[model samples]
Target: MNALSVIDDLKRRFPNEPEYIQAVEEVLTSIEDVYNENPEFERYNLIERLCIPDRIFAFRVSWVDDKGKVHNNMGYRVQHNNAIGPYKGGIRFHSSVNLSILKFLAFEQTFKNSLTTLAMGGAKGGSDFSPRGKSDMEVMRFCQAFIQELWRQIGPDTDVPAGDIGVGGREVGYMFGEYKKMAREFTGTFTGKGYEFGGSLIRPEATGYGNVYFLLEMLKTRGLSIEGKRVAISGSGNVATYTAEKLLSLGAKVVSMSDSDGSIYVPDGLSQEQLDYIFKLKNIYRGRIREFAEEYECQYFEGERPWQHVACDIAMPSATQNEIDGDDARALIANGCIAVSEGANMPSTPDAIREFQKARILYAPGKAANAGGVSVSGLEMAQNSQKLSWSAEEVDRKLQDIMTEIHKQCVKYGTEEDGYINYVRGANVAGFMKVARAMMAQGVL
Candidate 1:
């Protein structure tokens, strides 16, 4: 039951993968105590089995641009595990794609998938093609090429990829088209497709909605509510957008939202019209977050980061990994930031997590907090198989229910005798137990 021993085992097993090691290190630390209390986990050697992925696939992708030029990109798929079902996660098309990052993501996805109580496994794949300023034709070509080699390795019953950062509905559509053309069959090979296709409702907002729903459970456990609570969210993507929508719907006042460029503060809650415009700009137009401040009358900052001198009751880091560092965590704590739940993957660094735990602030990891998207992706897979589609409200209700259940599991397993919830421990233990049992049953696959 020694966490350090498990970490040492992982360290030796994965010497070349610092990112994977870093991501799983905290979980190992928490696993020691959980395994001590629950003898079955340690008896089965679950930690050793779950630390490494089943397979890692990397391919070279070459495509031509509009200017009579060819570009080469690297595509990777990390199939973390397959005990429960086929590999399921998002395909992110961004320049930042790397094996280590993908491995870390896939590793986290194993537990995230288990937390959803779904029959999906863990996998993530993508390329290094940055879609930021690419023309539509260029994107289409890139996606087509990316899927050409990928098509052979993926399928509905093999691995289903959704969309992630820099990969929106546009990218999903392009990839799905190519996949269909190459595979010559219409199946749920991908989730997060356009609604006109087989994509399920509420997939776009599921991650954000799930995050707030999980936070709501945490708040409710502490006899608190979101009503009239000033909140700061640090993203403008699908996850951030729907989170904003859900927060507003429940009477919470969102003070600020941001993107990679900068964050903007609107003392008054963002109106529906403003939210609509921002959604169009980011989701459709591929616009930037700073435009929200320029187009609307909100307090704005440029060429900088968020977590400045603002004060709020809750802070949601919806942007990329490590956006909230130790200093940002201190700033939040100083400004009465009582809770933080990540909407983006690894949004908070190790130091930021320590700061929150030191101050006894409610904190939830992205794996558990932002699991709604894949949960709904699982729903989409179900719809595809059953040939039945649910309404947005139905999907949203399921998402809320799953997220609330995850929070309760975290509290039930992670709370101290004094009722202080350590969601990190709770999520790690709860997610680990399911995956470990599955792995043990499967016998070393």
Candidate 2:
């Protein structure tokens, strides 16, 4: 199939859905050569099928606030593909949730799951309801209302949902409890559950830790080490903090962390004590990153990201999608940043990626780098199925191995003539080949 033509047709059909279009264009363009090399894929129209979701579930979620007032929100579930295995992805709860965003996420999830070498498909669901400033009871009621409509469509062996940006362990627990009450059976319909339930060990730290592991592998190719390197990280959530914790344990200096409000830069590098304070500030108190700047007397930038301003040996964008643009990438390269390993999906824009590739710097896309979260979610599914839970060490070891294998796949497919590894091309081609072959073998289903 002609990649540009398909993208044009998609844009025409899906007007105003820039996120989904961008995701589809990126993958299709990256895999165009290999996709054309396979005649069966074109004959079977696999590209068309792969780009469109298998099904979409949209419903209304109505709940009562603490004031006993009623509110209604739109919820959605986009099951993109399940040719390989069951549908697996996160359930985000934010005001930004929409068909376009969820579709983009589901499309990305398909390849991300494939890279994990797991028998899982791509899916994403969420609501337009924001969890910020909501009380516990309000959140619980909203989750229950969401599951009331969703329980009939999902099962452990069908579609399993985890937590995303606004949905955390608390939200997962609330939704799982509602599902259990409705289905009358305790199964692994959800991951990232509380440890007291069927949750797996180190699930929270898996993504961040796995990102570092992948970065270390990339550094190994250039005869470099993370030790003594100054690192700039974005986001103060689970992914960013755990990434910082792991880096510190490995002798790296973490120089920055951020939130929705702004970023905090500690030029001297953050200490364990400072990180602990950040943990309390963000996790416990649910405060902003500026609090850390105030408490530690560091530099704080309001309404800005931590990329162009921070001078570091490494950059990790763990916040959100399209955070690092071309200018930020150019600045990072100009400031001598050597590597970037994404902890959030699609955090780097297309121009930024081009900048990284032009500079020949070690760069990893979110699908390959930030896949540890879903890799561990896959593990959680296995544990729940077998009624067994692995120890923290066992789970951590498996995560490391998965990240290593993903890096190997990227290198295998992404290496250039001059020896610079194009991880974006590598990840897209590798992931697309697997799903394309599977779709072809399944015979137009």
Candidate 3:
């Protein structure tokens, strides 16, 4: 497979979809050698087939506000692939929800799910309805309307949607309730549901905890540990919150957390009190990071990211895509930062990733690092199917085991002659091989 030719064609076909093009280029470039070694893959046109999604559902979601104002927003669901099992992914509800971003997410999910060793395929859906300042009723109405458009496309054994970005337990609950009312069934059509319902234990904390676990494995490669490490983490959402929680318990000093508004740097590290406040502020009250800075009297950088300012042993980008650019990567490397494990999807740009790879620092891609949420989602499906709920300890044990296996797979495929583990290459190759074999066995669709 000629990676450049395929990328060029994709660029021509999807000129406006830079994110999608970038995602395709990354996977195709990483898997080119292996894909070429098997001529049958080329004859079957597997690369192109995998680049495009199996189907995409676009629709309009109309909801009413508290003042009886009718609002309309675009909604989408991209089912990327189902060669392995049923479709599975998240529903993001940020204003930035576009086809390009969802397409990239679904494409990335295809491989991310493959790495989990779970029987799941790849899919993603969301809408442009920003729930930032909306009241609970407004958000609930929007979620219900959003589900009204695509409820028929998802089911317990078909597609299971979870939470992402702006979607959370509350949003998932609203959607699931609407679906249940519409379909008259109480099934696990959605993961990340409220614990009172059918939500799995530790599902909310899975991504963050999984990221830290993957970082632990990476640290073990150098005979190091997370204890005593000063860490700088971005974002104040579930991923960053639980990442800091696990890190604090492991004795790591978490110095930073941020939001779209800005970042706060706590030079002395955050206390449990501070983290608790943040959890309430963001989750319950829907407040900002600046509020935390004001309460804790920390240095807050408005309209800026936390990467260039925080000097720490580790940097966890749990924010958004393309957040860490080339300059941020160079700053982290120059500041003697040793490792970076992403808790968000595609948080680092290609240039930033190149910087980390050139520096030989332990850098884990989001597909492998941030896959914990979906891993637990797959487990939730299992528990729901059996009509049994696992204990928190049991679920956490399974999550840790999955992360360790993902790391071992990365090492097996990504280890280089220089004794450096290229986790990005390792993850992509390992994930691709699994999906490719499955697709091959199923024959052409």
- Candidate 1: Cα lDDT at 203: 86
* lDDT tens digits, residue span 1-445, model 1: 6767777877786677766777888778877765677677677766666777788889999999999799999998888888888999988888878887888889889889989999999998888889888999999999999999888888999999999988888899999999999999999999999888999988888898899999898898789999999889988988888999999899998888888788888877777778888889887788988777877757777855567656889988887877888998999899989999989888888898999999998999988999999999999999999988999889988888899888878988899987789899899889888887777777754
Error of 1 at 150 (Å): 1.2
Order of models, best lDDT first = 3, 2, 1
State every prediction's TM-score relative to the real structure.
0.95, 0.99, 0.99
Residue-level lDDT of model 2, residues 114-230, one tens digit each, is 999999999999999998999889999999999999999899989999999998899999999999999999999999998889999999998999999999999999999899999
Model 1 residue 76 lDDT?
89
lDDT of each: 0.86, 0.94, 0.94
Clash pairs (backbone) in predicted model 2: none
Q: How does model 1 score by TM-score?
A: 0.95
Better of 1 and 3 by lDDT: 3
- Indicate the residue-level lDDT of 58 in model 2: 98
What is the C-alpha RMSD, rounded to one decimal, of candidate 2?
Answer: 0.8
